[model samples]
Target chain A: MKFGPMKPQRRNRLLLVLFVVLAAASAVGLALSALNENMNLFYSPGQITAGEAPTGVVIRAGGMVVAGSVLRATESLRVDFVISDLQGADVNVSFTGILPDLFREGQGVIARGILGRDGNFVAEEVLAKHDETYMPPELVDVLPDSHNDPETFKGGTRQ
Target chain B: MRFFSLPDYQLIMLNWFHRLGAPRSFYEISGRLLPVLWVLSGLSILTGVIWSLGFVPEDYQQGNSVRIMYIHVPAAIVAQSGYAMMAVAGAVFLIWRIKIADVALQCAAPIGASITFLALVTGAIWGKPTWGTWWVWDARLTSTLVLLFLYLGIIALRSAMENRESAGRATAMLALVGVVNLPIIKYSVDWWFTLHQPSSFSLGEKPAMPAEMWIPLLVMVLGYYLFFFTLWATRMRVEILNREFRTDWVQRLVVGS
Candidate 1:
């Protein structure tokens, strides 16, 4: 059997269908772009420190927990740690609850609460964020400095 | 008539395509294809599971929990690709009014939904130990949840409509609309600040993990694709036979078998 050309009527319908699909896709794309900032899970320390994030209202700030910045209270569940963007901006987060299992020095964390007038972030809850890369203990031990390098794990900050 | 004539091979390809659109032809082709697919998928999945759980080393940070990636990542990957395939089938059905295309779309929804659910559940399980939270409404996680809902929504939409013809067209339109979410799910991590990290593997770039880690993952991913195709084709064949049971070919095949 010989292959035949599409009828003009059918060809018009195909073009109309393609046009509808493209138009719908672009509409959704525009809507998503408009809602982009609201879709972010948390604010980076850089944003918060720059006053880009609103103060006194409940908000979430996230970054790597600065190494050696954690201070635990002896009698209470209260803990204070500085989360940093690792590019100079830092925010102090004070929480009075149990931290998540992955919460540790140099680990990425998101704290939810209020930013105080004193520039301290009073966190009601804290959640850790893990990077995508994975390696064995032996491999990690071989390159201990790599883990400590902020450049290796820039996924911690939003910006 | 004004368009240039097709070559012999092109004509042959077009003939084969048109024939495959018929349920009887598809049934015969799939009957010969199913056994090979099932055996290969089974072997690949078995090897992949054993290799991932026992042979691969634990992550330095996440330890044993990192093993969840073998299932979680593959499920997510297959689930997204499944939706894309379903949408393509929907488009074909819409454009050509092909019965087999609609049948394929109908059969794929539930399986795709189940796989998407697996991805979400396994993700939450893995997140608890490694991310310190069971769930977070981050861009990546939220987009994936939307994907699961889209699958369920499609299935529900199909069942809700009484007319087969209108249901097929409606579901096709819905599937096409939701196709926009696939790219959102993929780029959410990179596009926005989310608790979920960016993908470890990307086309045209070196994988973030070492060869030892990614090799088994690659195997598991391919195995999952094979497994999905095996299940999809099996479901398609069963549905085709059920829809065509009154036809002579189907009755004769049933009696002969």
Candidate 2:
């Protein structure tokens, strides 16, 4: 439908609206693409075990480090640990670096890397994901019902 | 083309802008808005802060420290958008030669810079426990740092210029150029492997946080926006009075007050 009488002011308003629409459209388009490409989706051990995680893709997997699952190499910085979603599923993760001081067994952690063919999480980086206080969010639900108390939920020591 | 012509509505809108550009009208109109804005800003911020800090459950992971999010996230958000708002005002002053727009640009700079500073300080404080390091050259952190510098640069450029008109024009250009950094600061965590986490809030996607965690955050964010507008209007009024001291209306306003 043709627009009615093109008064000068009406035409200016239309032009301004058109310009703004075009700018907004392009900005939204750019932002969507950036978000799509850049979003490093986080997955849980359940998703990883179920083969829902994209293979060979760099993604974040977060969960509590399985109690007493840590194994440190004698001669190297390489360490192996198991992460569990606290819902019957788990992922074995291996990393070669100085673990963050906060990293420990039974605490929440997020490992960024690829899931290996042999069902291991080959982590490029392992971050201890606790807040200022001791409790890690990911581990809170995973802990046994009896260990729900914040005061009682302490870090698991390596045996 | 007929589309290029200025229509009647457009002229009316322009006329409104022109009228509002005058210091006297702005002073009067903004004066009416001041008390309402003050009450809204004060009530919202006070409620949001108290609710988030006391009533909200401690984050399962971050614990009490997650309380920082109530302040940090809101400050960071407002700080970034405040710069964009300043830049728009700068553009208006440059294109339309609106003295009020220039005053807005001048008044917004320090406030924006101060908020940006707050964001940085809070982020660093939050970083210590979460990241295990007080500082990292991560993409999000670095881009935010760059944003602070841009705000500082605009403030510095404005003060350095001896001529008021030149200062306005130069700072306007700088602000326009600095627009490139806004998106960068926003997308940095998503674009690269960064210790800093990705945005919790995004349009058309479910918030990464649970409603319980995010609801108070929304309240704080709203509070911060209101607070910024309140401060912005208050500062603009002071600036209008200062700039229009020679005008009769301002003389009357000063004497009456």
TM-score of chain B of each: 0.95, 0.93
Q: Can you tell me which runs of candidate 2 are displaced by over 4 Å?
A: A1-69, A72-159, B1-16
**Steric clash count of candidate 1:** 0
Show where candidate 1 strays beyond 4 Å: A1-5, A144-159, B1-12
Q: Candidates' TM-scores? A: 0.93, 0.68
Model 2 Cα shift for residue B11 (angstroms): 8.0
lDDT of 1 by residue, B1-257 (tens): 52247777876787788788989898788889989988888888888899999999988888899999999999999999999999999888887778999998999999999999999999999999887778988888988999999899999999999999999999988888889899989988877888887788888987877899999888888888998988898899999989899998889888995
Maximum-DockQ candidate: 1
iRMSD per prediction, in order: 2.8, 11.0
Clash tally for model 2: 9
For model 2, how does the per-residue alpha-carbon lDDT over A1-159 read when each residue is reduced to its tens digit?
Answer: 124567665566455544553575577558755664243335667767888778887877777788899999999999999988676788899999978765877776778898877788899887765522222376457655432212211222101
Candidate 2 at residue A151, lDDT?
A: 20
Scored against the native two-chain complex, candidate 2 gets a DockQ of 0.11
